[model samples]
Target: MKQLKDITVIGVALFAMFFGAGNLIFPPQLGVMSGASWMEAIMGFFTTDVSLSILAIVAVAKSGGSFYSFSSKVSPRFSIVMGIILMLILGPLLALPRTGAVSFEMGIIPLFPSIPQYVFTLVYFGMALLFVINPKGIIDKVAVYLTPLLLLALVSIIVKNMLMPDADFPLTKISNVYAYAFLEGYQTVDALGAVIFSGIILMGLKEKGYTDTSSQVKMMIKSGLVAFSIIGFVYGGLIYLGASGASSIPAGMSRTESFMALVERVFGQYGVWMVAVTVIFACFTTTVGLTTAVAEYFSELTNNKLTYRFNVITITLLSYLLANLGVEQIVLFSGPILGIVYPAILVLVILNLFDKYIHFKGIYSGVVGGTLCFSILMFICESFDSLLVVKDWLLSFPMTTFEMGWLIPAITGGLIASIIYKIKATRTI
Candidate 1:
């Protein structure tokens, strides 16, 4: 009974942490695009957004519950590089600021259109900083207070939409529904988040006295399953709601606009406040978790040369400035950067899962390096007109059409590295 209670709390907290800004906005937009193919679209979205995220958690847990340990198998330098990148991206550079931007856009602006975004962001990050400054109690605070309200609002909206007569779903606007949804899922960035968040979860479990490695891994896996199950349900409902309203919503509506439109359609004029309540709490909990995690990470990385309190202040202030960029612009800026980083992280997460069996540590460098090189190439070719030939050649690679052009290189690189390591060992013997 006690174990169940602990898992439920940690799991709900985990869900709240991951289900912020991008998680909320992306689903309905994908539903709008996928239209009648919503099922396929939701599955594809689940494949990356929820499934990969859960896998990342398990991977980190199995690798001793710290991203540094999980990543350092590639090399200590690689670990530090990955750590800095993850913290920055998950910190002021992207995700943290996004929570504030999303909250202001969806939560504040909708209710008080005349309120300056900068003003709302100031108040928003101030509140987030209060929670994060004392990081030990963050999980309890989020799970006990914030998550339930967010869930209630979301569940109510989803249920109300379900009871309504379905609007005719227009033909899907996408060419390949699965691939489009899969790629779009990258916007959630939860997989990247999972790598960092696993440590937080482990810490929370440790606080509950789960000290041993075996027990920690078991609890972490259970907590992840519980967290992602709820995420999958909410995502599916949101996507369905978007599909139902596809014909009625405007073609060029921004994700925030479409989401607000759906809320109003569900609950009438009063839905404005409901939208405010949902977005603010959802983004609030996430901001608290992320700010705490990133602050703790950098403080420890620098051996407390950067104090946690100082890191917290810096992150909050920086996020506030970036929040003023608005949601759309922030999201646009994040895409190429996430595209380049996510594949390498994904490869690392998968390799770390089987760390006990894989004696050749060089395989980690080979696989991740290969993935990164190909991912950068893919990004380059897609970005520049002069690289059309390179882009075409990349498209010829398996799964490139699915935006997974890194897979072949990763496998080939791992094999080559493994053979080289074996030869070296034989020569030494």
Candidate 2:
């Protein structure tokens, strides 16, 4: 019974970590494009956004037993390196920028088309820095007002859109709709977020230290299951709400614009302004958590001279610069990076799981080597996307984009890693 109640707090905290305000725009727009197949789209999305996410979180808790502990399998140095890189990627480079851009796109742009975009960007980021440097209960107090207001606004949009699905078909089309939908869902990077977010869950578990490994494992699973349940509910509800957009939204609208249109259509002019404020606040909260966590990890590496406050100032300044680049740019940069990072992260987590429980392999070194190799491939692919009109010529050379180049490389990397582990373990045995 105590465990059940304890699970709720941890579950809710995990929910908040991934529920950053940037998440607001991701699903609704996805659903809008999903057309009649919104349900399929949602299923695909939940795989990355929901399923992998829960697994990552539980995997962390169950494995190395903590974030650093899990990460250490790759070597403390490698772990820290990855942590810093992830923070920067999730911080000023990608996530922070998206928050403000998304808010402006969804909340303010349509309402004031004439205003200079930079003006909004500057103001929004300025407010974000102020809040992040100083997190407090007062903000929580405001959130009490903020969450309900946000939920009501979102609900209003969903209900209205459902009442009026789009008559026109989706402008964007893709085959293997489910697979694409699932991959598209991966764009949000929330699955990666689950690993970053296990801290809160770990803290709760610390309070109930078990005398034995068996008990600890049991507790971790229970807590993880609870967290996954809550997350599943939210993801399922939001994705369904997103896909239900087919009949109502106009064909020409961009994702953010479509969301705002729904807001306006449901609540009239006032709702647009209201949503703007809500989005800015929501974005602020998420960035605070991201920046703060990065700083905390860095401080651990450097032995406290780097302080959370200093990290915030630095990250916020850089994030301000990056955020100005616009959402499309951020998305373009983030995609390939995640491809590399996600695979590396997954391999490491899986290794941690096997080593801790079964005591079977050299999980750490294999992860380190595999990540370095895979990240290079990801970078090469991303470069192709940036430089060439396309990679048709490169595809002929070897494992390329189409014809399953990526698949073969990923499988080979995993196999090589297993062999390396076996060699090391054999020597020890």
Best by lDDT: 1
Winning model by TM-score: 1
Q: Rate the local accuracy (lDDT) of all candidates.
A: 0.88, 0.62
lDDT of 1 by residue, 1-429 (tens): 999999999999999987886777789889989999999999999988888899999999988998888898889888998788878888898888888888877787767899998888999899888888887868898898889999999999899989997567899998999989998886566888888888789889988989999999999999999999999999999999898888878879998888888888889998889889888888888888888888888988899999999999999999999889976787787668778888888998899888888888899989998899898898888889999998899889997766788999999989989999999999999
The ten-residue window of minimal lDDT in model 1 covers 326-335
Count backbone clashes in candidate 1.
Answer: 0
lDDT of 1: 0.88
What value of lDDT does candidate 2 attain over all alpha carbons? 0.62
In model 2, what is the error at residue 419, expressed in angstroms?
Answer: 3.6
- Candidate 2: 10-residue stretch with minimal lDDT: 135-144
